[model samples]
Each structure stands twice: as structure tokens, then as C-alpha cells.
Target: MNKIELLELLHQEVVPALGCTEPVAVALSTATAAELVGGAIEKIEIIVNPSIYKNGMAVGIPGFKHVGLNYAAALGALLSNPKDKLQLFNKITDEISKKTIELIEKKLVIVTIDRSKEVLYIEAIIKTTEGTARCIIKNSHDNIFLIEKNGVLLSEQKELTILDNQLYKRLSDLKIEEIVRIIDSCTEEELLFMYDGVLMNTALADFGLSEQNKDGLGIAHSLKKLTKNDVLGDTLFSRIMVKVASASESRMSGCPYSAMSSAGSGNHGLTTIIPVVEFAKYMESEKIKLLRALAIAHTLNVYIKQFSGKLSATCGCGVAAATSASSAMVYLMNGSTNQMGKTIINMIANLTGMICDGGKIGCALKLATASNAAVMSAYLAYSDIVIPSSNGICASTPEDTVKNLGRVSKLGMQTTDKVILDIMLEKVMNNN
Candidate 1:
């Protein structure tokens, strides 16, 4: 891909999001449907595939303390402008929160799981005095595919397919060398947007470490305390882990800050961007060099997700996003492109089997682990230490190794995904 094409890809994938993408996508669909009907909402019904259902089960929504798909649907139906897209909760207020709670108590919103649909599917049907409206999102978050009003089809556009058919295909076909070349060819002016991500996520990390965010998981806070007392050294690895985990905690706990999401996930963005930013700061690298490293990180992130699907059983933060971050770290250290490839291989060998049960406060732990591993992988690759291709499921080349990891995620993990969901659902049922 050329410079312009590379910029287009970054613009499409690296954007701001509030809260976890799965539940936010649920709200987006409901908001669209509610706007289409244009009256008092009598009831709302949300249907999602198993992957969406599993992911939204325990995650917190932005601007509210409540958690689950029911609250998200009600909040969208009552007070959301569809045009805001993923940042729909930017204007949520205390009164709105109370009203959304009343709507939930009234039980006007119902959510169900459909096992037969695609992995990323959400359908919202809203009933109003005026009419009933339906909206559907598939393939990726924010890609609305169909809309209908009063039994008549109003509009239909498959935006995801259009991008996937052309740009995504080109992206998936490029080798590691070509990806590095594309990042090198871009001017610094075209890549400054990545620094915006650093600022946004740093805000989240600050929130997570603040005393007012008492409800957060406290992993980062505890790490900082340990470093202060000499229980843990204040090294680069610990700092990177704490910073990235803090941002993940804040996002998962509904901090209301917009995260610069990568490949449709806020946690992925935290894992991919913060580690590289911290490394550059420690190394005292030039601004242009930092931008180029970020370009490599974000590009490789999108390329890996092209194989892993938008949502999957595997933890994208650990396996896909961190792998990209490791490669970027190698680049920042003035390591060759060959060493960068080895860094990718090391990351895959380390974190390929980490499962993604759902999005919740506990995700902070996984983000911390992934961040530390990423730094270690980069260091090892810089020292010329790498996992041999003869090992299990590893290929001779980085591109082929990524393809192997994709196979494990897409084909080998189907049964594992179902069982994990079953266990989660069983717990919910027992609680009731």
C-alpha cells in the first residue's frame, strides 16, 4: 500500500470510542432505531449473537454505574442522539441516569441471544406510538447495515463489506516488509493523529490512578504503591504495565473518557499505544521516530485483526495488539526489520492461548500482563533471542506465523468459546 492508502486505513480503524465497543454497539443500534421512530418509546427489544452477548454480559457502560445490555438499550432508547455513534454517552447526566434506571425497573427493554447469526451482530427493534423501527449492525461496530420503519425497508447499506472487499483484502495481502515500508513512506504530518491517542489514553490512566475512582479494579494503583514502598522496582517494565493497566481499568469501569480504539476495541488501543509511548519517553527518542513507531504499531494491529475477526474467543489485547506493540518497540530501539519480525514471533509464542471471557474490571489484569510481555519480547528480540520456527504451530516467517495464530483463534477455539459462554450464563442463572 502507498502512503495515502496507509493513511486511509489508519483513519478508518484508529478512532475514539467510549466504553467497551460491544455494549456501545448495542446502544448505537438502539439509538438509531429510537430516532427512526421519533416518539415515546413503548418498548425495546435487542437481539445479539453469542459473541456480542458474552462480551456485553458483565461490562460497564459509560456515564452509568449499571452493567449489562438491558441498561445500555434503555439508555439509548430514552436519551441518545444516533449521530454521536460510539460516543453516544458524552452528554449523559444524573437525571438521565435516574430516568434510565426507572426504564429498566419498568422492564421495557428485553435482550436475547441468537446463536445462528454472525459473530458481530446486533438488532434493535423499538416500538413507539408512531411506529416500530428496526436497526441492525453487523461485521464491525458502527457499521449499520439495515433500517426499517413500520414494516417498510427505509435504508440499507453494508459499509463493512465495501471496506473489507477492497482495503482489507489489500491490507491482509501485504507482507511484514511491505508494512514497514508503508510506515516509512508516510510524512510526519500525516501521522500526528497518533499522538492524540497518547493524550486521550493518558487521561484515562490518570483517572484510574486517582482517588476518586474508588470503584476501579486498583491493579495499577496497587502497582504504584508497591513501587513507592520498594516492594516492586520502578523500572520501565513496571511503569509500562501500570500505565497501560490503569487505562484499561478506567475504560472498563466506565470513566466516560474516549479511548482511541484499535481494531474495534478500547483495551486493544490501550495495550497497543501506551507501551510504545512510554518506551519513546524513556529512550528520549525524537518526535518523528515516535510517530513512525506508532504507525507500525497501529498498522500491524489492523493487519492481525483482519485474520482474527473483529471479535473472537482469544484475547485481542494479548495476542494481536501486544504483538504489534512489541514490533514497534523493536523499531524504536533502532533494531532491524528482521529483529522486528522476530519480536512478532516471540509475542505470538508467549500469549497465543489467553482466552477472552468477557470485558469487565478484570480486563485490567490481562492488559498489564500483556504489556509486560510485550516489553520482554522486544528486549529478547533485540538480544537476538527468538523462538525457533520448528516449535509448535510456529512458521519460518512472521507472516506465516500470524496466519497460524489466526487459525488457532478462528478454527480451534469454537468449542472453547461456547463452553466459556455456557459457564458465564450458568453463573448468571444461579445468581437469579
Candidate 2:
């Protein structure tokens, strides 16, 4: 791919998103459907793919103390501005929250799994006193493909077809060395977007650091305690873990802040970007190198996800995205393409199988573990230590190992996703 076209791909893939994106996607679709009807919506019927339902079922929505798709859909209908995209929850207010809660208590919303589609699908139907509206968002989390009112078409966009055919094809085709060169060749004008990512995600890290979390489990809190007790003695590795995990903690808790996301996930953004930034700062690397490294890190993430489907039963943040962070850290340490490749294989060989049960506060713990593995693999590769392809499922080449990992997540993990969802559904039902 031409370097110029790669820039456009970067702009498209990296974006700011609020809350857990699955729920935010839900909010966007319901709000769009409700707005078209233009009145008090009496009922909402929402059908979502397994991944959406699996993710949205447990994560809390911003500005609300509850968890589930019912509340997210109701609030999306009540307070959403279709203009907000994935960040729609940022504008939620007290009155709207109260009204949405009332709607929930009255049992006016229904959510069900859509067996018709495989991934990233949401179909919302809203009925008001005057008429009914329907909206369909599919494939990409932010894609709004179809909208209608009273069987009259409101709009049409080919999100599903275009995303899979054109956009993803270009992204998936990019080579790792080509991606590194593209970042290294860019001017300062081109890096402003990445710097914006540094500013946005770091603030969330600071906020996460300040949280007085109970159970001693929040990433910042836990890391701080470990440092104080002298168990984790390396300040550099500890700092990297704290910064990356803190950001995940903030985002996973619905901190009401939007993260500059990579490949449709805020946690993926934090996992991929913040650790590389921290390593640069600690080493006093030049601004240009710092910028280039971040660009490479994030692009590496998007590149990997092209093989590993965007949504998967496995934790993308830990396995794929953080693996990118490890490779970027290797580059910052002056490791060559061979060393970077080794780092990629080393990390994926270890962390490839972490299951993504759901998004919640506990996800920060997994992010911290991934960050540790990222730093460890980088250091190991710097010393010429790597997991050879002969070990287990690792392929001879780094990119091939990544492909193997993707195949395992996308194709080899069906029974895993089903078992996880079954357990989660059982718990939710038992609680209710």
C-alpha cells in the first residue's frame, strides 16, 4: 500500500470513544431510532449479535449505577443525540437518567440475542404514540446501515459491505516493516493525532490513579501498594504497568471520558499506546522517535486485528494490542526488525489464550498482566531471547505466529465463547 493511503487508514481506525463501545454502540442505535419517531417512545425491541450481547450484558453505562443493555437502550433513546456517534453517552443528564430509569422499571424495553447474525449487529425498533422507527447498526460498531419509520425509509448507508470489503482489506494487507517505515517517514504535521491520543489517555490514567477503589484491586491502587511494599522493585516496569492499567481502569469504570480508541475499543487504545509513551518518557527518547514509535505501536495493533476479528472470545487488549506495545517498546530500545519480530512471537506465544469473559472492573487486572508480559517480552528480545516456532503453536515467522493466534481466536475459539457466555447468562439469571 502507498504510504499516503496508509495515513487515511490510520485516521479511520483510530478514534475517540466513550464508555464500553458495545453499550455505546447500543446507545447510538437506540437514540437514532427514537429520534426519528420524535415523541415519547412507548416500547423498544432490540436484537444484538452474540458478541454485543455478551459484552453489553455486564458493563455499566456512563452516568448510571446499573449494568445491562436494557438501561443503555432506554437511556440512549431518552438522552442520545444521533450526532454523537460512539460518544453519545457524554451528554447524558440527571433528568434523562431518571426518565430512563423509569422506563426500565416499567419494563418498556426488551433485549434479545440475534441468532441471524454472527458479530457486531444491533437492530432497534422504537414505537411512539404517533408512529414507529427502526434502526440497524451492523459490522462496524459505529456503522448505521439502515433506518426507517412506519416502514418508510429514512436513510441508507452500506456500512457492512464497505467495511468488510474495502477498508479492512487495505488494513489487513499492510506489512509490519511497511507500517514502521510509514511512521518513521511522517512529518510533525502528521503526528498531531497521536499526540492527542497521549493527552486524552494520560488524563484518564491520572484519574484512575486518584480513585479510592475498594477491594484493593484497581490497577493504580494495587500497583502503588506493591511498589510501596517493595515487591515490584523495578520502577520502569512498574511505571509502565501502572500507567497502562490505570487508563484501562478509568475507561472500564465508565469514567465519562472518551479514549482515543484503536480498532473500536478504548481498552485496546490504552493497552497499545500508553505503555509505549511511558517507556519513551523513562528513556528520555527524542520527540520525533516518541511520535514515530506510537504511530507504529497503534498501527501494529490495527494490523494484527485484521486477522484476529475485531471482536473475539479472546482478550484483544492483552494478546494482540499489548503485543504491539511490546514490539514498539523494542523499537524504542533500538531493537531491529528481527528483534521486534521476536518480541511479537514471544508475547503472543504466552498471552494468546486469555479469554474475554466480559468488560468490567476486573478487566483492568488482565490489562496489567498483559502490560507486564509486554515489557518482559521486550526485555527478553533485547537480550536475544525468543520463543522459537518449534515451541507449541508458534509459527516460524512473527507475522505467521500472529496469523496462527488469529486463527485460534477466530476459528478455534467457538466453544470457548459459548461456554463463557453460558456461564455469564447463568449468573445474570441467578441474580435476577
Candidate 3:
């Protein structure tokens, strides 16, 4: 791909998001529909694909104590702003929270799962005193395909499918060398926006490591305390792990801060960006080099997601984003593109089987693990050690190996995904 195309891809994929993308997408859909049929919202109904239901079932929503799709939809309908998109909750207040709770208590919002829909799908229907409207977001979060008001179609974009198909095709065709070359060709000024990710996620890590905000799993907080006690040495690996995990903890616990999401996931952003940033700090790398490395990391993340599909049973943080982070780490070390490819091979070999149950506070542990693996894999590749092609799922080329990993996530693990969703659904039903 050319430089402009690569930058466009980064702009599309590496945008900021509040809360988990799944629930945020639901909110976006509801908000859009509610705005279309302007009036006092009487009810809201959201039907989502299995992946959305699973991920949005329990994750925290930003600035709200309640968590789940119902609450997200209620907040979205009440906000009634499609333009706010994922950051719809950025300006939420106590009155809004209380109104959201009132709507939920009245049982005005309903969420259901549709296993037959696309992995990233949300259809929101809102009923107001004036009329009813519907909105459908498919494939990517915030990509609205259909918007209707009072049973009449207000907007429908047929060209989006063609554009999305072409985008994925171009992404899947790229090789690691070409991606690195694209990064190298860019001026540091053009890539300076990449540092925003470091700043945004570092804020989250700082919040997680703080003593007071102990809302999440506490993985990062505990790890930091261990370092203070000298129980866990203040090594580069531990620091990177703690940083990434702390960010995840803060995000998963519903901190109001936004994360620069990579490949449609906030946790993926933490895995892909924080490790490379922390490593750059440790090596005292140049700012330009750090931005270049981030460019590589985010671009490779989108490339992997093109093959893996947007959501799957496998943890995208481990297999996709961390793989990119490892390759970027290699780039930061002045390692060859060939070494970057080897780093990817090492990452896939190690993290290929990590399952994604769903997004929750526990995801902090997975991000921490992925961060550690990224460092280890990068160092191994720098030392000229890599998993052989003959090994399981390892291919003669990194490109092919990535394709293999995607196949495992998209095709080989269908049953695993269903079972995990089934378990989560059963628990929700039992609680109800």
C-alpha cells in the first residue's frame, strides 16, 4: 500500500474510544436511532451478534456505575446524539445517570443476541412518542449501513460494502517489509499524532496504578506494589506488564478516560502501544523512532485483523496486536524487517491459543501476559532465535504464518466461541 493509504488505514482503525467498543457500538446505534425519531424515548431494543453480546454482557460503561448493553442503550437514547459516537458518555452527569437508571428500572431497554449476524453487528430500534426509528451497524463499529425513521428508510449506503471489501483486500495483501517501508517513508511530522495514543493510555495506566481507584481486578496495582517491595524486580518486562495491565484495569473498571483503540478494541490498544512506548523509554530511543515504531505497530494490527475478522474466540490482544507490538519492538532495535517477521512468528507460536472469553476486569491479566510475551518474543528474534516453519502453525513466511493464525481464530475456533458464549449466557440467565 502507498503512504496515504496506510495513513488512512491508521486513521480508520486507531481512533479513540470510550468504554469497550462492543457496548459503545450499541450505544452509537441506539443514539443514532433515537435522534432519527426525535421525541421522548418510550423504549429501546438492541439486537446484536453473538460477539457483541458476549463482549458487552458484563464490561463497564464509562462514567456510569451500571454495566451492560441495556444501560448503554438507555444512555445512548437519552443522549440522542449520533455525532458523539463512542464518546457519547464523555459528558454524562449525575442527572443523566439517574435518568438512565430510571429507564432501566422501567424495563424500557431490551437487548438480545443473534448468532446468525455478522461478528460485529448491532441493530438498534428506538420507539418515541413521535415515531419509531431503526439503525444498523455492521462489520466495523460505527459503520452505519441502514437508518430508518417511522418505517421509511432515511439513509442507506450501498457503496460501503464495496469500500470495506477493497480495504480488507488491500490490507490482506500487504507484507511486513512493505509495511515497515511505508513507515520509514513518512516524515516524523506526519506521524506525530501517534504519540497521542501513548499519552491517552498512560493516563489510564496512571489511574490504574493509583492507590484509590481500586475498582477493577487490581492486577496492575498489586504488581506495582510488588515492585515497591522489591518482590517483583523493577525490570523492563515487569514495568511494561504493569503499565499495560494497569491501563486495562482502569479501562475495564469503567474509568471515564478514553483509550486510543487499535483494531476495534481498547485492550488491543493497550497491548499494541504501551509495550513499545515503555520499551522506547527504557532504551532512551529517539522520539521519531518511537513514532515510526507505533506506525508499524498500528498498521500491522489492522493487517492481522483483516485476516482474523474483527472479533473471534481467540484473544486479538495476544495473537494480533501483541504480535504487531513485538515486530515494532524489533524495529525500535534497528533490527531488519526479516527480524521483525521472525518476531511475529515467535509471538504467534507462543500466544496462538489464548482464548478471549469476553471483555471484563479479568482482561487486565491477559493484557499483562501479552505485554510480557511481546518483549520476550522481540528479544528472541533480535537474538536470531525463532520458531521453525515445520512446527505447528508456523509457516515458511511470516505472512503465511499470520494467515494460519487468522484461520485458527476465524475458522478453527467456531465451536470454542459458541461454547464460551453459551457459558456466559447461562450465567446471565441464572442471575436473572
Q: Write the per-residue lDDT of candidate 2 for residues 229-295, one digit (tens) a residue.
A: 6798658888878877777777777776678888788889889888998999887998888888888
Off by over 4 Å in 1: 158-164
Candidate 2 lDDT score relative to the true structure:
0.83
Tens digit per residue, CA lDDT, model 3, 1-432: 689888888888888999999888998998899888899879899999999988888899889998899999998888887798777878688988999999999999988888987568899999989999999998788889899999999888774542267765787788889889988999988998999999999998888888778688678878987887667788998999899989998898899899999988888898889999998998899999999999999989888888777889999999999999999999999999999999999999999999989989899999889989999999999999999999999998899999999889889999999999999989998998
**Which stretches of model 2 miss by more than 4 angstroms?**
159-163, 211-219
What would the per-residue lDDT of candidate 1 be over residues 25-135, giving only the tens digit for each residue?
A: 899998999888888778899999988988889988878989999898888777658899989988688988887888789888999989787558999999989999999
Q: Which ten residues in a row have the lowest lDDT in candidate 2?
A: 211-220
Model 3 score (lDDT): 0.89
Residue runs of model 3 more than 4 Å from their true location after superposition: 159-164, 229-231
TM-score of each: 0.97, 0.95, 0.97
For model 1, the run of ten residues with the poorest summed lDDT: 157-166
True lDDT of residue 100, candidate 3: 92
Q: What are the Cα lDDT values of the candidates?
A: 0.88, 0.83, 0.89
TM-score of 3: 0.97
